[model samples]
Target: MDWITHEEDVWFEFRGNSPHQLVPGRFYRGTVDGYADFGVFVDLAPNVTGLLHRSELDKRLESLTWEPGDDVFVQVKNVRDNGNIDLGWSIRQGENEFRGARIHDPDGEADNQPVESDKSEQTATIKTKPVSGKRRHVGEKSEPKSAAAETQSVETEVVEAEPETEETTADDESRAPTASDVVGNLEEETEEAEAESEQETEEAEAESEQETEEAEAEEAELPERVSLGIIGDHVGDHVTVEGTISSVRQTGGPTVFELRDESGVVDCAAFVEAGVRAYPEVNVDDNVRIVGEVERRRGELQIETEDLTVLEGEESEAVEQRLADALSDEARPDAIAPLADHEPVAAVGASLLDAAEAIRRAVLESRPIVVRHTATADGYVAGAAIERAVLPLIREEHPRDDAEYHYFTRRPLDEAVYGMDAATNDVTRMLEDRDRHDEKLPLVLFLGAGSTTESLDGLGLLGVYGAERVVLDAAPADEEVAGETDVLVNPAREGADARDLSVGALAATLSVAVNADVRDDVSHLPAVTYWENCPQQYLDLAADHGFDADRVRELREAVALEAYYQSYQDKRELIADLLFDADEGLAGHVSEQFRIKVEDEVETAEANLEARDVHGVTAVVLDSDAFSHRFDFPPTALLVDELHRRNRDGDRFVTVAFGTDELYLRATGDLDFRTLVESAAAKAPAAGLGAAGIREGRIEFLTGAREEALDAVLAAVAEQF
Candidate 1:
């Protein structure tokens, strides 16, 4: 056999050649062949025999009489190899019991079965047994027993036997009696028995009713309703009423309370007395029921409150809830403090101005001034620069309506003069206008380069319109002047004339004027001669063939010192180039001074030397040789204290350079160029030549030899100048 298995269905088939069959586990339906008290015999298959146990029958149906030779549907519960099978003889097929039993027909023929009317009566009788205490006739008894035993035995036997007889009697009673007189007789007897049974039931029910009435007469009863007012009255002299607190007042010591309910506001005192703190303070709008003694006073009943408990109010409750919820192990109680005081705006601004003024003064006194000024679109002006002379003192200064205070530079005039003329023109205009209106210009000071001096001057011209100039020498070294000037000239010797000088000498002299310290020995120096000695005029000639003579004289006196002028020109030139490029309006004039001074001084010196000592000579000569053979060195010295005092008060002395026939000579202090040059000859190879013709001298030299010669020349010039 082969079986095909599907998800929810299975099919069986025989695969072998021989015929084969399969049977369900143990049970099968069959027809009853015979019956006995123990079981019924059935034919399970074509030749198989089975037994249906009497116990398997419906108990009610089994008591009813049944005959052999009946057809039945039986289930085979078990099968034996000996051809015995366990069968179930049920009046119903599987799952069809409620529809009624399937009664078997005898002789395998439907005609041999009982009629419908008979079958109905039989089923009804089998389903219902007679109640206990019923009697039976003598012929109904099929077994024998003693008196007590007979009664019990008879009752049990009659109960079992009654269903069969009663079924037949009921069928007969239900139908009209035919010519079969036996069925009619059975029905008549059954009716008479039923009538007697009805009478006995009625009498027993009447007796039960009498006993129930007697039992009902023996039980007990419960209590009645009463009032609770007698337990406690008026809450022991305090009246507690529920109401919302509408207003609260803190009077004397305690909070006086007033509450509102549906009727009206109830006045309640929170304290026992005016200054007593008996009850807890209550906040406004608290819903509460206060208990207190009602006392008569001032023609009114006042509540001398004992307890004022709040029922509901959010104002205090919310605060309390927030406080409680915020409570944490890490919370700091002292973290918050009350604000002390605050200052007015005017006071703060005044303090700030005072402090700024103090700092400004300190910087002006101790450091160089570098001013940066900004002019607003609204005509407000501000600036910064180095300090020179103190601003002129004036009393009760008043400014014009269009005027505003501005800061200005205080650097020395020489250094300030180095700034561009246009920028200085602006500063001059601003200062003059401001002074005319009696306005005070603000000032700032700094220690480093005043690179923006020209810009400040320009702003001054636009705002103040006065002759304003930055003094660069006031700063340490030539730091401030280097920022403004285009070309820095370092003269080989002091007092060299700017007009007749070679370009190198002219360049060196301008650098010295802008950044030198003055000495007493040079105190008698003529300002014009010193101006003519600087390189600025040569630079001017190179740029525009014109020099500002008045400006040069002013600068000579302003710088006024020798050592201040001797710093390296290379560093100053770098600063100047960075600050003022050639394209700037002021840069052209400054650059002109540089180129003209270097080229002209070199040309003049060379021409003068060629015409005199080295005429037609192609070989180079040293300045030191000419100096040594000519003029004698001068003696120049002064008291150090006196010199210091003069410098402190911004006074400076100068030297004069004169071009003579034998050699160009410089006179400053007690020294002359001739002696200085002779002294330098022992150390400087280039020192033996005239300063002007040094560049033309050619000696077989290694790398850096020319540069060393140049350095030597410069050193000698610095000492002599």
Candidate 2:
């Protein structure tokens, strides 16, 4: 392209076709074709437009004063294989500023030839290159010239190249061609050339799009597979992992699958639709392989599943066997040692091993433990011992501080039975936690409770939801209830006297088995359970640690008073302090209050006691409805325990404290509530007397037959005597 000075304006002349006229690194005169968000598009040649991107601009696009169709000077930055032009802003605005005003002529036989000009005498020749790889000179001698001389030479070439049609039309004088007519002809050619360029660009884009799709398909075929243990290192990396589904939970956005392999467990989330099941056939404990990208959400590592497939037959069996082997090797304790030297505690040796294994598995599998115990001093001691032992293990196993509180809970039961009321509360709360927080279903444990037939319904409800159950009690556990629980630790099941072994003793033994580090802290708990007739073995163990009878009693009283204050809460820290920590005045102060409260209630019950001889047995019947503080501290059950302890002589004695709807009996003689309820029901056929809670020595009778029930139960006690 060559440029000529026409008056004050500069005009461009193309010596070849439009495509070859604009060469890379050459200056060209162009028009401001249009404005766009990115930059300004300039028409450099007839059909060619180049982008002057915002980055390449010397000044702000908004500050540019050029309008559409206004001429501007630009340099060709690049010419792509697809014929796209990249333009750069040039500060040189006039044609004279360019060296020699060189023009590329593709059609010239001699690339550049001298054309003597009539404009200026101080002339310089132009040296040019042809598109066919030939170089020629415009004059005999070619050299660099001043800007004015270059302007003069460029004007000479333009005049000599003027078409013959312009000269002929000028001589006709009838209708001569004007300079405006020549300009109009060039504009028509430019419009046609632009249409051709646009068509070529569209075809090139279509080919690029096809190539991109093929590349993505190839990438999908080759995904990296990794193990669960190493998945954390590959966060944000797409990988595949194979394992068995340990659990499944559906949330608002995705279905979370707990994928457990030999190495570890990771959650794989699949989103098919909001709250919709991703793989309907997949269930808990099924073997499957998941392909997903590892990601961290809310500070926990998760896999965003892109594909999931269920394994069957040999593959599924292999996965399950691998996981079973890993669990057996890693989670199970190598050996079991009895926590006590007593025969009753040692009799259930296999059950203790099973119990420890269950607790260990719950910790390893990340299942929360729900411990329910009776709300008595002994029960609190037992529950607190397990809590003390398990919480430290939970903290050691998990990194979170609140994991102990969140994953392990010890709830106090009013009585030693998993009654329907307690079960309902547990079910409601666990279900709410599961649904609202995506928590795993907890392993329900009953210590000092849920070992009798009375708790069968409660255990069965949890069983219906596939939850695991563990029962550890110092009571005569029913065979049916024992069959329902995964682990049953009961001395009675091994033909030992359950009455001699307090629940606190049994639960503390289990606690020591769960975590050996807390054994010293919980050694005195068994002695705290017995108010009188403390076991010689446990007393000796406590005495070895300076916890004499008085100290043991103080611990019991402190726990009992604290238990009564918050009857529902476990009061974990307070109970732990009283039992595990040093005897630091807390027990002494609280024990004095417990003694005063119990003595006051006992003195009042003694004044109202009605003693009578029924069938040669002394029956000290106290109307708990009239004398006892029916709604206040020192509950009827505890009061009867104290009354029986204070008033029992060398004769057969039975204390029957009947309330509004229930009966509380604590006997010094050989009168088991289980036998009394059976014998009393035979005497009073209408009273439906039954053992309501064997551990608490409670019996149930129809309120309508209260008088008959009392008489029949008294007669039964006399028969036992």
* Sequence-dependent TM-score of model 2: 0.62
Specify the poorest-scoring 10-residue window by lDDT in model 1: 376-385
| Each candidate structure's count of clashing pairs | 89, 1
Return the number of clashes found in candidate 2.
1
Q: What is the TM-score of each candidate against the true structure?
A: 0.16, 0.62
lDDT of model 2, residue 626: 91
TM-score of 1: 0.16
Local error of candidate 2 at 540, Å? 2.4
List runs of model 2 lying over 4 Å from the truth.
Answer: 1-319, 434-438
Q: How accurate is candidate 1 locally (lDDT)?
A: 0.33
